[model samples]
Target chain A: MLELEIAHNWPGFQLQLHLTIGAELIVLFGRSGAGKSLTLRAVAGLFHPASGRIILNGRVLLDTRSGINVPPQARRVGYVPQGYALFPHLTVFENVAYGLRSSSKEVHHRVMEWLDRVGLADLAGRRPHQLSGGQQQRVALARALAIQPDVLLLDEPLSALDAPTRSELQALIRTLQRQLNIPVLFVTHQLAEAVLLADRIAVLEGGRLLQVGLPKDVLHRPARPEVAHLVGVRNLLRGQVRGISPEGLRVWIGEREIRAHWDPAAPPPPAGADLLVCIRAERIALVRPDRLPPPERENLMEGEIIRESDYGLSQVLLFRVYGPRLTPERDYDLEIEIPPYVYERLGLDRIRRWTIAIRPESVHGIPCG
Target chain B: MDWFPLLLSAQVATLATAINLLLGIAVGWLLARRSFPIRDLVGALVTIPLVLPPTVLGYYLLVALGRTSPIGQALEALGVPLVFTWRGAVVAAAVSSLPLMIQSCRAAFEGVDPELEQVARTLGRSEWEVFWTITLPLAWRGILAGMILSFARALGDFGATLMVAGNIPGRTQTLAIAVYDAVQANDPTRAGILVALLSIFGILTLVAAQQLGRRLAA
Candidate 1:
């Protein structure tokens, strides 16, 4: 377990992050300059914070109030910085041997063992420059793990690799973390990468942690508008709860009232409360105009196609919801995405007008940040 | 021609380069990695010898280390009077060549990625270990070129060595001063030999620098 509460003041940005990471992989997910890397560096003792306390596996690494701060050399934390930063002059064997300072033979054996574990034992004689990018990254990981740290910190380590190599190292990291059973804090801006590797996701924006939860929870039920946007929610509509009935909660989007679900796991808000609804583009389905009408519990809106685009595997359609009343506050232009097969099966490419059906449970209400 | 002056000049250059190697790397690393209130001032001071006329620098050293000055008196009491001695020539050469050493070293150290050092620290190596095992090995090629440049500069120093060491024959007369003396004595042949040797030394040092740089780059 690792607990970090740090407030750092840079020239133009201030980072105030409070997070507790369990022994699972916790990915610090955010855009560039979102303070994810800064948080990792602070935990590694490379960046000093103005105030905070950091505890790693019951060890107090830093406590500003008590003036207790451990240097990076004493922190005993494994850090794989961006670019791998392998010592260009050292061979892979020597690079891995850097952290092992005991008996020479024992160190050599351990270094070779780690090299073999990372599938670089044969290339231990080669320098970092002689290896491919993925090989160098594995060597860096081997060197960091040779120290046997209690916490592992990785800063976009796979961002520079090709797709195949990136996924290969991703699996290697998962296996290593599972075998070690140590808390790993990985940083990345790629949403797909985070979803694939993160046991829990912590969303950082503007130097603060906006939300932290399982990948499914954060993706389907983001707590804030910014997080909803970061997590790839394209259709965020401002709505007010009109009433709660046996069917579901009714929300007013523009002039049209739509039925949305209030998750039973979450506390129900009062009626007439203002909230923002997040519906992922993929969740909204398109129905042909001539098809049989669906149940009234589902949100059915008639809209004209304003824009459409194809991204190989799926087609994105932009639609404007049509209503009799025109309210300046209502932006009913909804963005919907359907897989290529769905696009072909529904003959979506043949029409300009269609009805989009949004399930009540799919429309998630996120309180404004 | 007596070979003693040439040998003495080589010896002085070697010793001066050695001293500059240590002083330059220390000051250069400090300047490259740290920011203090007087950092710019210290940088300018280190660069003074590079821009100052060699004769002016020699005069400044003479004034500071002359017999009547307090520092000179202290050194004399310590049995290390510097004026009119071969050691004075070495001191003159080192002062003149220090800026080259320091500038090259600073650039080299700055070129090194600090992230590498940070990673080394997180790997449980102390600052000293990181410097030796990571920083020095990575930057040594540039540092070597700097040392060679400083040695060549020291070898060719004339005005400063002539003033402080007084151009004594076979004792304090380095190759540069010997060439000047040969020119004054109307001995073009002797001057030609000494000048050719200095030029060849400079060319060879430059060649070595380029080769080392290429090898390290590869």
Candidate 2:
């Protein structure tokens, strides 16, 4: 287990992060300058926190109260910085052997074993510049693991690779994490990458952790509207709670009513209490106008296509509601995502008027207060 | 040409180059990696010998290391002497070439990415291990070029060595001093040979420095 409670003041920013990571892959997901890298630096003992304690496997690596701050070299924690940062002048074998210089002959064998594990054994004699980016990353990983550190910190290790290589290395990292059974703190801003690799994702913005949970929990149930936005929730509508039923709660958004999944853990809101209902774009379904009359649930709405775009694999459709009272005057805008296959089958490109339905379970409501 | 002065000059230049290379690496690494009070002042001081007239530098060294000065007295107490000696000539050449070594070395060390050092540190390497296994190896080409430049500079040193060590035959005289003495004595043929050799040495050192730099960059 790795625990860090640090509060440091930078030039124009303050970092107060408290987090505990177990033996699973915990990804620190954030945009650029969100302090994810800084947090990793603090754990590596490269950046000293003005006040905090860092504990790794019960060893206090840093504690201002006790005046015990281990140097980066003595921290026993391996850090693979962004770009892999392999020693450019050293060959792969020497780089891997670097950490094992102090170890016994048995440990030297282990270093070679790790190089083989990372699939860079054949390239061990080559310098870092001679190896591809992916190969360099593997060498870096081998070197870091040679010391048998308790915690492995990776800062955007795959960010520099191409898409195919990134995926390959991501799989390798997952396999290595399971094989090592050591707690790994992976940092990345790519939401898809975080979702694919993280056992638990910590969403950070402006130096604060907005939420931390399993990927499904965090994606399906964000703690805040900002988190929902950051997580790529395409539709977030401000509304007022009308009433609660045995099924779920009803919210009045603009002149329309919507039903959202209710969390029993949340405090009950009054009838007029404002709330935010969030639903991911991919969770929304688009129906032909001739399918049938709208459902009785508050989620069904009639809108006209305002904008549409297609990526190679997916399509995004932006819609604006039509009518005298429910015109585009309202602040809420709805976006829907469709797979390429669905886009072709529905003939969505040939029509402009459609009914959008958000499943009740897909809509998550958080009290604005 | 008589070979005595030529051989002595080569010996002094080689010794001075070797000493300058060692000291240059040490001082350059320190200046690049460390910060302290008057660091800039000390850096400027290291280059002062390069800018000062060689005669002025030689005169100061003579006064500082004369038999009466504290350093000279201490050396004398240990039964060692540096006054008007070949060693004194070497000392003057090394001082004159110090800036060349330091400048090249500082640029080389600064070109190394600190991130690489950080990676080494995280890999359980000690500070010294990182320097030797990573920093020094990476900067080896630059350091070599710096050594060659300093050696070439030392070979061409004249006024400083002439003042401190005095132009003694087969002893303290170097290539530059030999050429100066040949010119003074109206021995134009010997002087031309010595000057031609000095020019060839300088050009070869420069070409070697360029090639080493290119190899390292590649």
Task: Name the candidate that leads on TM-score.
Answer: 1
Which model scores highest in lDDT?
1
Q: What is the DockQ of each candidate?
A: 0.90, 0.71
lDDT of 1 at A319: 80
Look at candidate 1 and tell me the lDDT of residue A193: 94
What are the per-residue Cα lDDT tens digits for candidate 2 across B80-162? Answer: 67878888888898899999999888888987888888878877778998899889988888999898889888888888998
What lDDT tens digits, residue by residue, belong to model 1 across residues B106-190?
A: 9889989999999999999999999999999888988998999999999999988888888889779899999999999999999
Q: What's the count of clashing pairs in each model shown?
A: 0, 0
lDDT of 1 by residue, A65-99 (tens): 99999999998899999999899889999999998
